[model samples]
Target chain A: MAYRENEAEAHDEEHHEHHIMSPKVLIGTWLGLMVLTGLTVGAIKVDFGAQANLIVAMAIAGAKAMLVCLIFMHLWFDQKYNVMIFFGSVIFVVLFISITFIDTKRNEPFRDAYDATNKPTPEGRVLVEPTVSPISTSGSDAAAQPGELKVPEHQKPKVPWPSQLPDTPRVAPTAH
Target chain B: MSEAAIDADAAHEDDDHGHHDEPFLGHHFKDHDHQFNTGKLGIWLFLGQELLFFGGLFCAYAIYRGMHPEIFVEGHHFLDVNLGAINTCVLLFSSLTAAWSVRMAQLGNKKGLMLMIALTIACAFGFLGIKYIEYSHKFHEGILWGQLFAPSPEAMEHAMHGVEANSRLHIFFSIYFVMTGLHGIHVIGGIIAYAWLLKRAAAGHFGPNYYGPVDFIALYWHLVDLVWIFLFPLLYLIH
Candidate 1:
């Protein structure tokens, strides 16, 4: 037992040293991370047009995450197997997001149809299709005009409110 | 007190076989490198799984944010950017110290290792402290998750300012709570791990031949920071 122990101890002494990441490298990585963080925050201020802004922010963040993985986590110098494992997770995450987006897009037309069927139109009031022309409501006009309260064209008393039509009895359609 | 006594002391020291008595080395491993390398591989696998776990949440955030882009744009205004930035710095600095601790252990600088571990723990606590303030502010403002969401006057004002106060705004706060809450739990776990490492370091269990625990824990700490690196921009830096 003593002899075996001495051999193991000799092995331990022989392999005691490891690749110690230098303090300079670590501090440099931290500085790089901080700078990337600042860039992300600053990118938000740049008018990158809505979608582009989000893209830029995500890009900066991705850069920061990569730095942490490569330097601080030691994957840059560590075994290739470990890097493979980490990137595998990242790749799976991207796949998950991509699948979800595809499904959402696939169902979008059905969602629009559902909305059209369920949307309620008030009695006697045709839903005005939106137009490029400016729509000024008489209410705002009346509020603005102190002396004259001109009735809006839609609210004129000459138009009769639509009376409720009698409920028509109908047979239920048979299932084919 | 005589010359013979000194000679006997020297003879005893020689008989002990200096640097060969490592009580910490387990019998199964051939040497320290084998044990350390094995531990490192195991930790990498565990960290990979951790990434997958959090990846699910990130996917959820992505889907919802894509669906209700306006909700996120409006809801993010409630979160204070300065606090998030400060916490990010704290976690990054802690990661630095955590990495340093591993180096110290490898160099057999017990004092430096212990001090770095302690600093890492302190920084972890500071992170939780800031997170607590942020969470409480959210709670007090009634920006809660799901059914518990009751927007305070301030939150209501912000919501009314845009997107017509869709109840789906609750989804943003829900994601916020779930993601940051999980990360907070990770931070707490990190604190506990660092504290345990500090005790072991104080007991002189770690050194050049057996610093696997320090290295593994530092790797874990860096992962926590890495996750936050993404979370900070996604949640708090919304344009």
Candidate 2:
């Protein structure tokens, strides 16, 4: 046991010098992350177009992820092979998702159906095909009323959808 | 021993004696640099797989959100922004401390490593605590996934400000639960991993030449933070 203790002490004496980041870097990274998070919250208050907002949020998120990877994860100082492995996986994921979306976007009938039902307007959405008066907010029972087709008073669409008008002439050849 | 064999052993000893006698460096490794590089490559591959694992869910989220953008805007309101932001900060702070621990281990500062590990573990628990609060609120409000989603009357009133009751709202919550739940599991994994590393650190198993565990675990912790970095804005701050 004494000999083992002596060995341990000797091991301790043989100091191994390596790279050590100053505390300033850690603090700076932490502060930067916190500020970016604050920015995310703040950006939501501004009424950018929905797509723009999504893009902005995602951009901020991507930036934060990069910081974590490069600094906190030390990918900046890590081997080139490791970086290559990481980006390769990211590329595969993006490819998989993009391919799936390309297919999903191509299907016309389903896309139109989804749009008509789930997203009735560019400004407002009508997710459910309500049978009853939307003004009646008592409960689900009020939603059971049929034939009226009353749009909810609170969620009224900003502009009437062209599809909802019977008087408008159909431009498609099939309509004639 | 045969004379030639004895000579070979002597030569091997001579070759290794002046070089790093890093205790953790395996016999098969040629040198410290070789061992570190191999371990680093393995960790990066592991991290890459982790990205793909979460990528599948992110793809699903993107596709569904594209299909029904309105549901996300409505569903996000049910999530508290302050709680999510706080959690994000907590996780970010934990990541910093985790990175610091690796640095400390690299510099042979055992005390600093132990302290940083403790701080990281504490921040992780703090994140979970906030998450629990947010989840319990959602549970009570009946904002749940799939068939179980029965938004309360109050929630319905708020969401219906300019839209009808969204039937597909359940899908949003499903994504929310799955993504965040997976992230939470990662946080727990980080906590357990850090605790183990802390024990090892206390036992003086790490130093400049052999701080592999500390470094690898820091990378894992950063990935956990990275996932949350996306989840926070996507799930909570959506307009």
Candidate 3:
């Protein structure tokens, strides 16, 4: 037991000395990170159009982030469990974004068609288009304008009140 | 120390062969080397998880950039490249101090360790001060995100004065703020950890034989510096 214990202590001391990252490697990572940052910033300006720009910028950013994690964070030297946890979190984020984008873009068409079929008509349940008449009285323009407002007096809109002339093709504005 | 903290003699489920009688060995570990390996491994794993957290933010930036490429290009014009580069240089200096601190600890040089750690902490504060200046400038520019808030147009006008881009540029700022802010939090955390270790180092809690904490903390601080290395370009450089 004593022998085992002494051996463990010696091993412990050796372990402590072995794991510290060398300063040379440390300097290398620093330079790498600096260059990577410069490149990513430079790339943002090139017009890879819309989609292409996003991908390229992110890929570079990911690579840079990885360098920090691997070299400075010691992820490159760490335990499997830690790597697993990190990867798991990343996966969750991906799933969330995918689900939300899909739900927004895919369900749009059916919603528009459904809204159109439910449109209201004045005469019948199934909703038919109103007929246009030669002496249309759908509004009050003829009531107020002394003969000059006429498209012919009989053709004046017949809403009864002069103030009741609703402009065609105009929808009243609604509050947001 | 409690017996719980020293586990060498308690139970051996496997064959106890070529190893025995190791003094000052923790009870929890099978051997000193194994314990050190585990500690180093643990630190790296934690770092990986942190990287992934930032990774998600990077992914968001990509998606938004793809959707609105012009906005990113225009947003680049607003970044103060000189300031970003200076801050990056400042952080690189901090990493040097951090590495020196760990080296001092390994050599059992207490005073050198404390000074280096203090320098590191100061660098972190310096980085933060630069960050504050940048954010306030943004406040002056009417530049901000559209998530649960729109930056008051008045302030944004000052920060992004003379800049021409769609309102979508605000999204770019949003990602910028979140990513940089998170990185700042890590820097703060690293400083605090270093401060605590600095005290222990002063009291001789670490030496040539027990420098794991110092090494790991330095490693963590270096990672913070590493993140800034990339941020400087992505945020400040226009071309």
TM-score for each candidate, following the candidate numbering: 0.76, 0.77, 0.61
DockQ of each two-chain model: 0.28, 0.32, 0.13
- The lDDT ranking, best first, is 2, 1, 3
Off by over 4 Å in 2: A1-17, A114-176, B1-22, B158-163
Tens-digit lDDT track of model 3 for A3-76: 45664565554432344668787788778766765776677678886557556766876776676667655566
Residue A165's lDDT within candidate 1 is 28
Give a tens-digit lDDT track for model 1, residues A7-73.
3564554322377888899899889988887888888988988889889988888888888888777
Question: What lDDT score goes with residue B166 in model 1?
Answer: 53
Cα error of candidate 3 at position A163, Å:
34
Q: Write the per-residue lDDT of candidate 3 for residues B7-44, one digit (tens) a residue.
A: 55445522463244543456567566556667877776
For every model in order, the fraction of real contacts preserved is 0.68, 0.76, 0.21
Error of 2 at B96 (Å): 0.7
TM-score of chain B of each: 0.89, 0.90, 0.82
In order, the Cα lDDT scores of the candidates are 0.78, 0.79, 0.64
Top lDDT hit: 2
* Candidate achieving the largest DockQ: 2
Error of 3 at A168 (Å): 23
Mark the regions of model 3 whose C-alpha exceeds 4 Å error after superposition.
A1-176, B1-25, B147-164
